[model samples]
Target: MSNGVSTSTDKIIVDRSRSHRNKAVSKAVRQTRERLQTGHVGNFDRELIAMHISAMLQGASIMPVFVVIIAGLGIYFTRDIQIFTWAFLTLSAHAINMLLAKRAAKQEITSESARKWRRILILGQVLIGCCWAFFAIQGCATCEGQSFAAYKGAMLLAAVCVTAMSNFMLPRAVLFSFAPTVLALCFRVALTREPLDLGLMAIFVTAVVFFTFITDRLFQSNLKILSFQSEKDDLIVELEVAKSMSDEARRRAEEANLAKSRFLASMSHELRTPLNAILGFSEVMSAEVMGPLNNPTYKEYTGDIHRSGQHLLNLINEILDLSRIEAGKYDLSEEAISLLDIAEDCIGMVQLRARAKNISISQQFEPKLPSLWADEKSLRQVVLNLLSNAVKFTPQGGEICVKVGWTAGGGQYVSIKDNGPGIPEEEIPVVLSAFGQGSIAIKSAEQGTGLGLPIVQAILAKHDGQFILKSKLREGTEAIAILPAMRVLQSLPAVEDALTVGRKRKSFA
Candidate 1:
């Protein structure tokens, strides 16, 4: 498929996937917000009821044993038969509560059903509380001269403590479970007006308040934990969605890149075949090799054709070079080469162009620099591209300074500086990108494919080197290509020293 069609298809796929993902995320977020909102109590109530029911079911079998044990002890202390009645009543209330929780758990617990079940459970707690109240108010007939009231108060406090710990999940149930008993204690203290009864009532009220506060705190903590867990689940879902979208984008990009590479690969041959014919035919016609073109206009037209074909061919070659480099197919033919010689050769090639423009070219080189292990053609291209750019931008009678020297890190560098209208600071990155020219370059009448600098940068990168471009508006531009120290092959010893060393090793052997 063509690049445009492939891009459109990828866009459609991405949009459809994003639309679905966005819808799902929005729905999830909306539902979570509704559940957590102050005005919408139904969802929150459902969750709370579900938790309470689970806790209630877990402690159901244990409640009866605890009731029997407490009642048996109470009977031994007070020697009253009514303790049996309290035990039976409390056990009945607990059984009713357990039945309600089981029913809620068995069915789907919606908000309405949760509210209804919570009320019924609280009522069961109140019934149990009334039984405890009766036990608190009853007197110990067989145990005279003993502190039975205090013993009753201690038992009531113990019951309150157990209720607080066990029923903290259902805060309302915890409050209602002990409210009646505390009320009965208050009434007993008011009617008797005795010091011991008043003191017991005081301690009982304080204990109830303390336990109530603790239950509320526990309830709040559970609420916070549930909220955090919900948020964490939401974040995990979002991260997964983002990751999938990223993977999809990367896959599409890779497909598009492959398509581009194939298209370029095919066009390179298709374009060059016709282009070479046009250049060859146009060269013959311009030279009047077949027959003298008597018309001056015909000769000029043939010359134009030849020049245009040559420019197009050069552009095609550059595009192919950049494509191969980007695709990592441009393997370097490493050999020991002199940076100074390469720079000098490139300067000589561009000397005619500089002379045509009346531009001055100066060279500076450090002597005795070591040879570098690199691809000679790629390095030559790098130096030539930089020189061509400098010559192109430098004005009439402008001076271009070229330098080759050692880098601070024991590497070699070739720098080409021109006294031309420099690029703007903001447009530096634009000029560096493929087919990206700065505003100034675009405005100028120069013909450029904007591939020169990018090709130079790519070639340097393949050599494990660096490219630096510094420009100031209306002042100048300097382009530097640097090769690392590892590529700088160190010089070997002389032949005589090597021969002596070889002879010494042979003698030792």
Candidate 2:
């Protein structure tokens, strides 16, 4: 029975040994094949890989000291000289590799340099793997019972920690460093010829396979993070370039607009001089003040000439006004003035033209509306323009309503509404632009230069007031100009403290 048990035990050891050997060989083959299939590291990714390796090396530098301490303890407890020697050699080799890796990290890693350093670090990892294998083999060789279990546990724990530490670095380096040590451990345990040791060896082999899988996943994750960072940096650079181009284009546009304004300003005096002379001469000829024309055709021709000259002069004046307003050159002469008085005067001026078209004018003036601190000339012009537009657009017998009152917010407002074919809502912006007549205004017999509303808006802006135009198709159009409350003059309290003083002075006199 004893001889039979010995034979069975020996057979089990041989079978386990063979199984473990096959596993190690197959694992190595699979790793080699996978590595070859993966091809070379990308040129762009090489530096990142080097950086990762350098970081792992720096962190792993301290790991050797722990191994030395653990191995020294194992030697003290078991009195094993080989274990101490292996520990010392591993510490020395790891320290040297750490110094070299740190030096390499400081250098700028180009593609060529990265490849060279990768190979050197991998070779160092292989040497460290050999040292660990030696410790595991020699430490467990002479150990027995509880000492054997403790030493095996400590060495396995160290191997797992080392594998985990290297997971962030190149997978090839991790495989080269950890696989050999783990395989040697499995082989050593399989030689014990005991069922318990063989089972433990199987567990170790399985752990190594699982660890390699985890390391591969970690390596792939690091590559993904690096790739995303590179893409983000590239997008940021592109956005900066686009923003710079947009700024340059905007600067050029502003310069061109400034040049155009300057040109218009410089030519204003020259253009108006000839226009004024033409109007003066045409007016004299049309009125026959110089002399009576003998030909009736000449009289009619002078009338046409006078009207054309007047129209041209008005257009030029409107252009110059708008240009000066845009150039910030229109100065206001402000005074305390009554808005009601100005509205009345403007209505009176346009009443003749309105009556000629049979358009009835109506007024709604707020009783005792406050006076405005404003530019009188500009205010008068604003009112006149609104009144003229209302009269011109209104058909025969159409009614025009002009109102001067306080705004809801306590400001003064002048509103003019005309019962005419109202401007289309979409064309309101066009009519408010310089020389941008609406389709309705262009079709009407009273076509204007289209500068009226823009001028009103500009003048109101200068006064810190607001101009609002509201109209609907086929309904009447209303234009409102509001002066802010700050511009509305308020009267002082009359004789609150001075009433008694005035009465006493009267009695004394």
Give the local distance difference test score of model 1.
0.83
lDDT of model 1 at position 462: 91
What lDDT is reached at residue 499 by model 2? 80
lDDT tens per residue, model 2, 198-273 = 6556666676677767777877767766655665565578668967997999899879878977777677777778
lDDT of 2: 0.75
User: Residue by residue across 1-509, what tens digits does model 1's lDDT show?
Assistant: 01111122111111010122578768877876765553221236778879888988997877788778878877778777778888888888888888877888998988788778778778878888888888777777787664687677777788888888778878666668778877887898888787877887788878888888999998887877777666667668877998999999999988998888899999999999999999999999988999999999999999999989999999999999998887789999999999989988999999999999999887767778899999999999999999998998889999998878777677888878999999999999889999999888888777589999999989988988888898999999988888888899999986677889899999999
Candidate 1, superposed: residue stretches over 4 Å from native: 1-43, 61-84, 138-158, 286-297, 336-338, 363-373, 403-413, 482-509
Best by lDDT: 1
